[model samples]
Every structure is written in C-alpha cells, then in structure tokens.
Target: MSERPGLDIKLPNGRHIQYRGIRYHGSPQHIFWFEFLPTLLDHTIREELKKTAELAKSTSVSVEQSVAEVVALLNNLVQRAYIRAVDVDRSLMGDGFTKGEARDVAHNVEGYNKYIVEQSNVYVLEYSSNEEKVNYAIVQEDVLDIKPNFCGIGININALWRKIKGKFLP
Candidate 1:
C-alpha cells in the first residue's frame, strides 16, 4: 500500500491527532473539519495539497526543498544587484553627452531583471550632464532622485535604499 501524505494518530484516550506529512500535528477535527463541511463552506487545503504533490512528483523535488532552493536563488540575485550596477555604470560612461535633450536619464539597469522575477526591490540610476557624465551608476537599492542641477542625489539614493530594503528584506 502507498503511504498517505498525511496521517491520523489516535491516542489511548480516543482523541485523534492529525499530521500534515511533516512536523505539523493537530486534532483531526481542527485539520479536516473544513474538509467535511459543505462545498460552499469548505476550505481548499486538500485541493491545494493535491496540486502541490503533483508538482513535486513531476519536478522530482519535494515542495519543502523547492521552497529552500527558491529562497537561495532570490538571495543570490539580491547579491548580484551590486555587480549589475557596475555594468550599468560602464555602459553609461561609454556614451557621450548631448545637451538640451532632457539632460538627465535615470534608467533602471539591474532591477529590471528583478522585475521579471517579481522581485524589483532594487534600482540603478545613471546621472549625466551636458559636459560630462558620471561613470559610477547610483544604485538606489530602494529609492531614486533625479534633478536638473540640484544635489542631494546621494541622500535620496540612500533613503530609497533603506525604504526598499525595509519592505523586502525584513
């Protein structure tokens, strides 16, 4: 017989203990009460679990393990944001400047990739002027500031970094 993904363990006192295939243990009524209820009132935990199991079996990776792998991948991308900023800076530095045409362009260089993954918590900006452009891209790990001539760009970048990191990291 195939082992059930979940199980019920009964105690000597006739109380039923339910398990969710892992360390999750609780009363059967608490775990499966929604299952026994009417269709309109029932929750979809069973259906969701079935879908998860199907995905895991097809991928040959357990759901728990997949979650860990995904988290690690996200962390790696977060670290790569730094390298991406350097590349953006180099590209901007290579381009010569022309006056009177917006004069300022703050394009997202690294975090654009993160947006594809639905994790656009970081942004890089390229500050340029009419005469010369800065090679070092302003990495707004949280916020970005664009002004014609006024300064405080660094302060705005740091503030934005703090805000974004606070929202996504913790």
Candidate 2:
C-alpha cells in the first residue's frame, strides 16, 4: 500500500508534529480521530525520550540504567494501547502549556493522576484499572512540558509496567 501524507501541525507545546490519515472532521472531534492517536503519541513520546536521554548526556544528572528499562517498557505501550483523546476547546490549545489544562485533565479524566508540577508543566498520568492484563497512560506533550494541550486515555494490554511505574513517580 502507498504511504499517505500526514497533516503537519504545531502542538500546543511548541513542538511541530505530524499525523497521518488524520481527517479533521468537525474540528477533528470525531470518534475516528482516536484511531490516529497512536501515531501522534508514538512520535511525541519518543521525542520526549530523546529529550530525557539528551538531558542526561548534556547535564550532570545521572539517569540510572533501570530508568532506561522503564522507558523501554512505556514505549512498548505505544503499540498495545487503546487511546481516548480528550476534547478541549480548540482555542485553549496551540503553542504553549497551561497549569489549568493539566489539572482539568487529571480531575476530569478518571483513573489518571493529578499532577501539580511547580518546575514543569509536564507529567505522566498513569491509568489504574482493575484489569489484570493491561496498563495505560494519559500522555500529554509526551512530557515535553507535557501540556494538557493534548491528553488521552491509552490502555495497554499488558500485566507488567505496574511495578516499574513506582520507580519514577515523585
């Protein structure tokens, strides 16, 4: 099959991103939009992993090897996930992060953690479910100021990652 072109758009966090086969039906709020989230989020999250890896490389901070393992595991969730994209006012989104948007996502979305980050706008919202074989995250900016500008309900059909998640949470 021939590859399709993606919609080149700017994320609210000042990052340029692309979405393939993304049809903006009624402002992109259609249920079908959820079908394209893995592509969008997979790119966004890997970019974030690059940033974190770079920070460790450039700065004095040291990232433990176990940390890399956790990242790898989360990356795996990118494929095994089922995402529920949040519906926000289009005007409120675009080119920057806001604390209110972050809070709104945490409070309004079930199971995701509420994060109050003083130094950064980014945080991972891990979803807790009763299912024994799955894990999920509400990824935003994929942690690049991981804005509330875009967040989702991503469910991973895996029994692992539950124990590893505790290693990074503050």
Provide the TM-score for each candidate, comma-separated.
Answer: 0.22, 0.26
Residue-pair clashes per prediction, in order, are 3, 2
lDDT tens per residue, model 1, 1-170: 98777666553344555566553223433343223221211112223334443465466554444333443554454345434544544443343452121211123223433332332111111112212122222331223453333563334555656679999997
Model 1 CA deviation exceeding 4 Å by range: 1-60, 94-170
Task: Give the range of the ten consecutive residues with the poorest summed lDDT in model 2.
Answer: 111-120
Q: Report the alpha-carbon TM-score of model 2 versus the true structure.
A: 0.26
Model 2 lDDT per residue over 79-129, tens place: 234222333333224333641122133322222111112101222211112
* lDDT by candidate, in order shown: 0.37, 0.38
What's the lDDT of the predicted structure labeled candidate 2? 0.38
TM-score of candidate 1 to 2 decimals: 0.22
Question: Least accurate stretch of 10 residues (summed lDDT) in model 1?
Answer: 119-128
